[model samples]
Every structure is written in structure tokens, then in C-alpha cells.
Target: MKRSVLFAVLFSLSLHAFAIDTKLMVRAKAKDAKFVGSSIGGAHIIVRNTINGQILAEGITTGSTGNTGLIMKTPKDRFAQLADDKTAGFLAVVDISEPTFVRVEVISPISRKNAQVHASTELWLIPGKDILGDGVVLEIPGFVIDILTPNTHQYIPLESIKSTGLDVKANIVMMCGCPIEKGGIWDSEVMEVKAVVKKDGQVFGELTLANPSRNLFEGNVKIDGAGSYQVLVYAYNPTTGNTGVDIINCVVTE
Candidate 1:
């Protein structure tokens, strides 16, 4: 009898050790394109243990469909996860003792044959407990520019960027002779410009570039809505015509 009781106790503990709860769901859309070859409409999910920087689990799904659900387990009470949906992509989850930070990367693939073949990645985080009331969501949109030297000036609207959550500060970085400005001409209504620097799509640092200029401006701005933002960078001289402006990096810090 004693041996049987000990055996049952150990078995119960072992089952509980590996139990996991689904914490996040991700979705992707391939706009203006069809789901072709393995290279297109393909997506994957990855989970990581944030505390020790170890990967917990990973899997793949189809982007042509709707949202793909991802579940992960935690060793401790506090945890974080990063999710990416693209070719050669992964999602990561992390565990932290205190309030910690993690990174998320979303890659939008464009077809060389068709510039309109744009891919967008969306992520959602589901909390396990009610410790943090009304969890915050941050969003950052991606952009691409194709310009020909000598007379291809274009103004990419910042409103084209998209995100699902709040608390995301936008950061802008650019090269020389790129005229990047943000603000409204009437009553200071021009949308505020935020700066974010990201590695692998996860936000590391943030600043606000309100009515920013070419001086590498940085500051903090509050996000009022949840959606896409267009990142605009133009040539200071229209006569120079069509100099390419690259939005080298962006990040969201919460």
C-alpha cells in the first residue's frame, strides 16, 4: 500500500510539470496575391522560455487561411513570448521573474515580380492570469519604397502602417538628404511621429520624433488608436527627384 501511494503521487506531479496553456494566436494575410508555391502563403509559430532564453516549442501553419493558434507552457509564473509569421520564421516565449521585455518579429514578404504582392503579419497575446489588468497591446507597421534616381519623389503616408494593440512608440531612422517630417500644418493636428528600433522585429528601444527633421530626432509620443500607420520619407529636394528613403529599422517598447 505504501509503495502504491508513492507511485501515484509521483505520476501526478509529472503530468502537472508538462501541462501548458494556450497564450497567443497569430494570423497573416497575403494581399493582392494568390497562394502559390511553398514560398508563398506559408507561416510558422515558435515559443521560447524567456527566463533562460530557451525555446520551448515551435510549429508551422498556412498563411492563406485565417488565424493560427499557438500554445506554450511556462516554468515559472511570469513569462513572455515572441511570434513571427513568414518564411524562415519562428515564435518565442520567455519567462521572467519581474516585469521583463521580449521581442517579436513580423516579416512582410513581397514578390519580385509583383510589388503589390504584400504580406502582413498580425499577433495576439492571451494572458494566463488576471495579475495585469487589461493587458496592453502595441502595434508597429512596416513599409517599403521603390524609387528611381532623378525624379521619383514620393510621399508615403504614415497612416499606412498597421498594428493591433496600444502602447507602441514609433521611431524613425533614415539616411542623409532624406526629408522626414511629421506634423499637421493646421492647429498642430499633424499626427505625432514616434521612433522605434527593432532587431528581428522585436522592440528594443523607443523615442518620439515630433515634427522630426534630419537631425536624428527622438522622443516619446502616446498612441491613441489601434491600426496601421504609413511611414513617409521623401527627398528634401524635389529637383533631386526620386532618391530612395529606407526605413532602416522600427521597434515597439511596452
Candidate 2:
């Protein structure tokens, strides 16, 4: 125990002589797109000195674990896990001339299908500070939904068929102002969730959404009589007591 503490202290004193090594763990999630965090290529990642705005490092976040980003330093000691679940975790050394704060930026490229993603986070560090337990979580917030499915704004050919009910199914993504991991977002304190449905500008109906699975809300909406309609889906998360919304457009034939 004394040896570990002594080594840590000595390393702190040697900051002026050598770069301070540290590990940076991050999680990326896509709300309206897929793989933006775990598999959708990588983001234009960067770490900058918040004091001078000078960039410290550049890289991307990829792989199945959402870590695999700009890794500049290797851990001096082994790390078991950071939070409730273990993250593959991105690692950065962050060469420090003195103890200070730094910023992390991850901007995901435009999704081939849906939207874009960007993230900014800041953390304070001391030279030779412990970099293991729970570390800093650089959360990259992606879009709002994975895909509206069948896409939106569709004209069913004014005379295509004769169906009474319009069935709308979508896998909605809800972000509880939390971090992302393993195809999902964590940090919910609520037990009840609902998806408020709307047509045009008026409340149509509401559907109780099941527990989210893999960052998606599995729900459906049935509209009996339709004209030119705008379908809106609002996901209510009681956790932070916030609601996320998305829209779908469709035209029903006469």
C-alpha cells in the first residue's frame, strides 16, 4: 500500500520532467441512426487544452464497445471496470505540463441514412491522478430515433388500396440525459413511460411503451381515417422527467 502511494506521489512530482499518463473512457450512441457509437465507422475525435484551445490529440471512436477512440496513453495499472457495466473504454495519455482541465470532442460523420452526431465534454485532472475507477465518461449524443421505418412523407397512391386503419410502427429511441453503452442508454429513475401520438397539430392518442430494449421503444399507432396527416411520436421518460419527440408524414388515398 505504501509503495503504491509513494509511486503515485513520485509520479506527481515528476510531471515537470515527463508527460502525465491517463486513460479516457467514452460512450457513443445514435438516437436516429445505427452504429454511430459502436459500429458506424468513427467520429472526428479530438482532445484539446481547454486553457489555450490547442488540440492535444486526434482520433475516432469505434469497435463494438464504443471505446476504440483517440488512445494516446496506456494504463500503468489494470482497470477492471468503470461503471455498472464494463466498457472497453478509450484511453488517452494527455501529456500535461501541469495539472489542468481538458476538453474532448467527438463529431460523428453524417449518417448514411439519418442524422449527424457531436459531443463535447470537459474534465479536470491532477498530474498522476488515479485514472481507473469510474473515470470521465465522454458521452457522444447521437440523433433522436434509429429509423422511422418505411421512411416518412409517403403518398400511398391516392387509389392504391382500401384499408381502413393506418398502421404505423416505429422503434423510437429515448435518451434520458444519460450516457450510451452496448446499444443502449442508461440512467433512468422512472417506472412509467408513454408515447404520445399526434396527427397534424392535435393530440390523436397515446400508447404506453414497453421497457426500452437496445435503446429503442417498440410501439405502434393505428389511425383509422386518414387524409394528409402528420404523425408525431413523443417518448416520455419519467427518469429525468423529459420527453423526446419525432415525426412521420404520410398521405392516405381517397
Per lDDT, the best of the predicted structures is 2
Runs of candidate 2 with Cα error greater than 4 angstroms are 1-23, 27-45, 62-86, 106-121, 126-130, 138-144, 147-150, 158-162, 173-227, 239-243
User: Compared with the true structure, what per-residue lDDT tens digits does model 1 show for residues 1-254?
Assistant: 99999999999887766554433332333321122213442333344444564544444433322112321122323554323343122223333233333233322232322122223333333433222211222221222233221112232223433232222222222211112344311111123334443434444445544433432333433433322333323222232222223343223223
Alpha-carbon runs more than 4 Å astray in model 1: 1-18, 27-45, 57-138, 146-254
User: For every model in order, what is the number of clashing pairs?
Assistant: 34, 4
Q: What lDDT would each prediction earn against the true structure?
A: 0.31, 0.51
Task: Give the per-residue Cα lDDT of candidate 1 at 5.
Answer: 100
lDDT of 2: 0.51
Error of 2 at 18 (Å): 5.8
Scored against the true structure, residue 68 in model 2 reaches a CA lDDT of 26
What TM-score goes with each of the models?
0.26, 0.54
Q: Report the C-alpha displacement of residue 173, candidate 1, in angstroms.
A: 20
